[model samples]
Target: MTEAVEYDVVVLGAGPAGENIVDRTRAAGLSTAVVESELVGGECSYWACIPSKALLRPALARADARRVPGLAEAVAGPLDAEAVFAHRDYWTGHWKDDGQLDWLESIGAHLHRGHGRLHGVRTVAVTGPEGEHELLTARHAVVIATGSRAVIPDLPGIHGARPWTSREATSARHVPPRLLIVGGSVVAAEMATAWQALGSQVTVLVRGPRLLPRMEPFAGELVAEALREAGAVVRTEVTVEAVVRDGSTGPVTVVLEGGEPVEGDELLMATGRSPRTEDIGLDTVGLTPGGWLDVDDSLRVVGHDWLYAVGDVNHRALLTHQGKYQARIAGAAVAARAAGGSAGAGGVDTGRWGAHAATADTAALPQVVFTDPEATAVGLTLAQAERAGLRVRAVDHDLGKVSGAGLYADGYRGRARMVVDEDRQVLVGATFVGPGAAELLHAATVAVAGEVPVPRLWHAVPAFPTMSEIWLRLLETYRG
Candidate 1:
């Protein structure tokens, strides 16, 4: 027998995005039901962000310590891999979802542990692990926040070779002696830094010319340099032809173009990500399965009044933080429509940069790569601003020249770039590459998002003798 459930809102996938939407909708007095096929907190909590950061933190800390004069002598030793693994396990709660489940219960949202699929308009069919069935009907809105999964390239013998994705790399119990990684994205760079420092000889093969290809070119150069200095092999402009693994417990050999082979205990394919919409019954709703969802600023799916797509599934921004931001806007819009008002009514503000609009997805998206020489950027790159047809000026500064940067490390090597819209006299983009660069991103984000004028930025002074003084240097360079 199939059970019938009713809710004001039905959300698929209890990831960070889904959980936030549930929180927002429930607070608006809307009854919300969340369906999850795996662990409650999803990828960021258990596998991607948390575990990966935990594995990288010790390595980063050690590198930072080595840069300090007195600390350098005292901390010249390898990290305790066992202890690091234990710490990572602790952070991920040993892959348990009890805490997340408790939070959902406290929020008064029903949790359906099953695979949920769209049956019809505003309708979802959930199948529990034991074959129990429940039909969930939403009176207001149905949101798809299922997020994305890693993409492994199709190569001969790849399946039998047992390649690791982002999930396996982050959650591995033991580090391999030789790690082979494919792709030049964040996952590849970060994992290479992590395993190499954690006692693995890492070899990275990038099809592109550089790593972190989406960001400014200097960012990739700096990261690649650091990886090589740390004894990792960074190979770019290479093509992987095939993979070969003889048995269950054997070294995997990656065959490259021109008859070259690279062998390692494990191979990780951090190529890219795809939306997890293939099996969610999108065909029933007149939409294509296995395709990215398209949504407007208010996150409402095109041509569907009762459907919404937030997070990575919407193809707006792939970062977890960006997904959460979109979730907040979508939740507000969903609640507004449920109350018999337009998304813009009742101070919802659906216009650009409004409470109901995910404007940051385009205007001021911020990203931080947690590499040894952390790279962080906001808004647009100089190239991006130029491509957008904006008249811009790029100001550059050497972070090592800053007094505070010199004090932070014996020899701080970094650079900062700010792209200014000449016509508007406001900052349109900023990028920082150096140790502790991630900490200096928010001010740049604010300047770009708020569109603060250059002259006014001079009045909004940075404290003397800090990495933040890079802003002052950049402004000085721009003035001259």
Candidate 2:
């Protein structure tokens, strides 16, 4: 028999975005239910973000220890892959999905274990482990937090060949002797670093001119240099025309566009991802042309009043953090509506602040690439700012001068660039590339988000001898 359930709000996919939404909704005094098929914590915790970084951290630690003369002798060589996996398991709590479930229960959110599908405008059907369960209606909203899946590129031999995606790369128990990476994105760079540190010779083939092309040129240059220094063969403006297994050598031989053959023990495709909207019954309600659930500024699906989309499913920013931000807003908006408030009342403004119905994503999205030398950036590129018709001034600073960089290594090489709206005196964008730059991004994020003026930011002060002090240097360079 089909079971009937009711929820003020039903969130599908308990990822960072979905979790944040439920958290905020419960705080607003709304009854919510979350449905998840896999691990409750979503991709960030188990697969994509967290685990990948875990694979890289031991490498980073080894590098750090080798830099300090006193610590160098005591520090062991590269991290053992087994030990790294053990540590990663501990961080992920051994992939226990129950921890996230408990958190949802503690927060007064109901959990449905199954795949969720939209049945109608205000209805969701859950096929749980037990039987057919129907969530009759959302008194307020139904959120689609279904994340994304990796996009597999087309190559002549790629179909038959077994290639690793982010999932396999992050969770692999052992490293291959040689690796060939397909894409030039941040994921490719990160995996290249982790595998290389674990004793794999890596060759990265990028279809684009530079790694992390989304960041500033200075930032990309620093990472490219770091990768080359760490013994990676970085190739740009190249395409993998074909791939085949060499039985004699037991390696995958990849042929580039012009018939140049590159061989590796393993192949990793870090091309990109596509929204997971194919099977979730978007057609049961309605879907847009690009396989997206079209949503307004508030993340409310257009035409379907109670259906909302969040996270990667919405086809917005792919970062887990950004997905969480969108989820929080969508959850709040739905809860408000359920509580007899207008769907748009006091809800986050999607326009000025990426509020629902807001198309201002490019203005303030933060991205970080955790390579040997990390790369972090937020907001528009100089070209983007100019295209938007804003008068922009950009300043680039060598991070070697910063106390933070000095502490990182005896001979430090890093770069920092900031784009300011000359008239507003507010940062339109910023990029930092070097060791420990990932931690340095929040100050810039806050500056851009808060619209802190250059002079005022100078007054805020970064602590002495910290990588954050580079902010002062950047500001000084801008003045000069």
By lDDT, the best candidate is 1
Residue 252's lDDT within candidate 2 is 93
lDDT of 1 by residue, 149-244 (tens): 999888999999989999999999888999999999999999999999999999999999999998989999999999999999999999999999
TM-score of 1: 0.98
- The candidate that wins on TM-score is 1
| Regions of candidate 2 where Cα sits further than 4 Å from its true position | 1-3, 130-136, 246-249, 288-290, 343-351, 354-360
Which residues of candidate 1, in runs, are more than 4 Å off? 1-3, 343-348
- In order, candidate lDDTs are 0.94, 0.81
| Candidate 2 residue lDDT tens string, 176-279 | 99999988887898999899888899999999998888777776677777778888889888988999986644789899888999999999999998887777
Number of clashes found in candidate 2? 10
